[model samples]
Target: MTSLALGPATPAATPRAATPPHAATPSGAAVPVTPAAAATRRPSEGSVHSWDLSTGVDGPGTRFVTFLSGCPLTCLYCHNPDTWRMRNGRRTSAASVIAEAGKYVRFISASGGGATVSGGEPLLQPVFTGELLHRMKHELGLHTALDTSGFLGVRATDALLRDTDLVLLDIKSWDPDTYEKVTGRPLRPTLDFARRLADLGQEVHVRFVLVPGLTDDPADVEGVAAFAGGLGNVSRVDILPFHKLGEAKWQALAMPFALHDTPSPTPERIAEVREVFRAHGLNAV
Candidate 1:
């Protein structure tokens, strides 16, 4: 689940022009639009990398996953290195994204799936993300999920969180040092976000990638499992085993793959890690 291949871009939806509330008077005088009304007419736009359909990996069922571009963390094992830069993405409006997702509303609804706003880091463009989530839930009549590292949790507004039905939070590592090593960032923010989600009673699925020699330490895994278990909002824990599916991506980007020599955890090791989560009274998979 840590690695998602970029899919084809959805056909562009025709951009709709915003209608100004102010009208011309018979005397040909124009009325000034209020600040609040102007804000409403402003379309939320973001840099979108790509989007794809996936089942069981993004959320509950098959989901219309939107992968926004740009991330603060340069994870050693990041698969989509192509999405690392915001400039690499195409500028897209939230309305266009919703229009694309709307096409599949009936199918997604029937399958018990919804829409997931994933990223290079969706929080990088919080305003656009919130718009997509809001429309996806209210307009599309679908469950909405946010796939985030939670590093930018502070950017998420309460209104944004209100629209999210579930959060697929990735706790790359539990130990602060290890977390920093795995992702060139601190761990406190993610933990803080988790706590906030717990307080808000937001549904969450904790995703942990088990990288050998880096994040495979039982204590570290236990640290994440324990923290997630303690958070009453965590509905399930996904023990994502590290894989080289994104190795070709790194090679294509000409970026050094630090874990090139590292091997994936065996089935038994994966099972063992899952047991650690189950021990903490969490539904681990």
Candidate 2:
């Protein structure tokens, strides 16, 4: 419980490159480690795809964002396909990642930002996620946000939420069948997570991508608006226009790229979808 809408920023992309060969930092703490630094440094257990210091679009302000690996969902629009499997990236320790984040903490805190642990799916490594969030809040004295599909919200422990200040929950589709088709995952878990988060009074931001042929239905958008409106903790809603920016990633992976020809939704269509949320008294951007 405690999920949806962390903030309405676009979550724009910078495709992650393959992890480079590693050499230690002279401290001998393993140049590459695993995250959640949750337990003993079990090298290779927790992993990360990549991390970058970014601004204006991920969370509230500038942030040190880490993208993890091993996702249950296979969304067609996912640009971080390289993060689909944990093995694709190097094992990293939470301490190491946080230390790297420490470099930008001052700048981030100055602008009211913190850290975001995004994914292939953060919930896939709950312990690591919980520990990472805990440290970001307590040790670093910074805000913490979790960006997720809410698909694995069940994995989030109370300890994890205690460390989390916001949740960026992406609701891929409102209709169950369509949601399944879109994400290759069930929709119930996300809805369940959203409800629990609201009940817990946790802050959340709902995000939806407006895909022309797939999710442009008036009923579908309206359905999402209705559900999000019912959640008292939702602070805002982001309307992301679908794009083919990830086509190359798919091609490189040799996976089918059916959406290559799928055009982004028209401005009018996007406006219409935003209106559905607005009509439901949501702050759709």
Candidate 3:
């Protein structure tokens, strides 16, 4: 596909050198803390968890995004393939993560934002994501969100939705065969999870990656719109433009780039798809 820019802006690199050690502030907190304070405070081990922090970009307010490790389905276009392996990531405790996340609570509150747990399929690490959200809300009083494909059977439970303030659910495709082709899995479970979440009256923002020749199909778009339209708890729909941002990552990891030759979707096409969702009364953004 055409060039993609996923995640946040990459920071400038610093040359490694022998120098004095210093403490670091938690990335994307609502407020900045002194280095001295960070150094004096014991870093919470947070279960040695594996998470890539994104300071903003995926919820109602300012957010500290976490890329939790592990996923059940192997979506061919997944950008973060490295997170698919559970054992490959760190295993930090919830307490430690909250302690570190707490350093940013002031920033979150001031900015009207909080933390988001995204993943290779965060529900794959339900206990971890749940525990972290629980602590963030109870201990730190911060809003919590979850970004998930909602494909796992046992992982889509009511308990998981309880701690979550918002659910960014990805609907890969409406057609089962096309979904299998794209994600190497079935579609029923994912759809079921969405409806179940909605039935429970949990707030949800439905997301669909606008992939040309795949998810852009009128039938697929219409199906998604119809399903979402019927949901009582679905508050909005987000149309994500597809891109090939992770092509280099594939090369770096010695993995094949499935969409290496695919072209990016045109602006006209994205607009047309947005019109479809708007027609269905689903707020498309």
Candidate 4:
């Protein structure tokens, strides 16, 4: 996704793919792959607090939402401004988080969906996410999923992917300029993340927010379609119609509303975006 500074979690804004059977191996020889730098980067010296786990239909069968704190991105429209501060929340050890998640093991077992480690950038706490996912999968037999921007480095990503069964990957914008404008981050990292996931043959659901004017450029949409379509492992593309539900969060945080007057896209625009995905032969969910 574009820079984290875009905004909070709203109805419209929220947060990948595979190759083939014999397609994995190269014809002649295989190029050795290395983990991403972000994965290897030293864990943030900051601590993490685990919020109470809850249920949701957002992803998987039933989600035990694990809200972790601390974020590096400054997306202006972020709804979870409360989660941005590194020191504002209480700390919970990885073991504690896993234990609590285990409490709902029955829920997960019955529903076929398990723990969802969310942000303020869950990848920021790679070790914690890895440990939690490991426990849930091996001990609890839970179906693990990651809700991430896919912008994290390979090192951290490798750890997180070890126990991850599915990924809810967000692609904020395809235009590098718009991506920088929205997230204050570069676009290549996110694209690289997607490519890496696809290369690994992971199950990914590509999500794009239909932000009026900002993310609606034909080139941008087409670019996203082209990228998602190229990934043989991508199961679906979800076009989320952007809404200002997080407008109140910006007020609560006293952040300026940069997208205040921007209304949700019309039915026609949503249809157009769906058509773009359909044209690419992607299942637009």
Point to the candidate with the largest lDDT: 1
TM-score of 4: 0.79
TM-score of 1: 0.90
> What local lDDT does model 4 show for residue 133?
66
The local distance difference test score of each candidate is: 0.85, 0.78, 0.70, 0.68
| TM-score of each model, in listed order | 0.90, 0.84, 0.80, 0.79
Best by TM-score: 1
- Per residue, candidate 1 scores C-alpha lDDT tens digits across 96-148 of 88888888889889989999999899988876787788889888899999999
Q: Would you list the rank order by TM-score, best first?
A: 1, 2, 3, 4
Please list the Cα RMSD from the true structure of every candidate, rounded to 1 decimal place: 6.8, 9.5, 10.0, 9.6
lDDT of 4: 0.68
Clashes of each: 0, 15, 16, 23
Model 1: runs farther than 4 Å from truth? 1-7, 10-35, 38-40
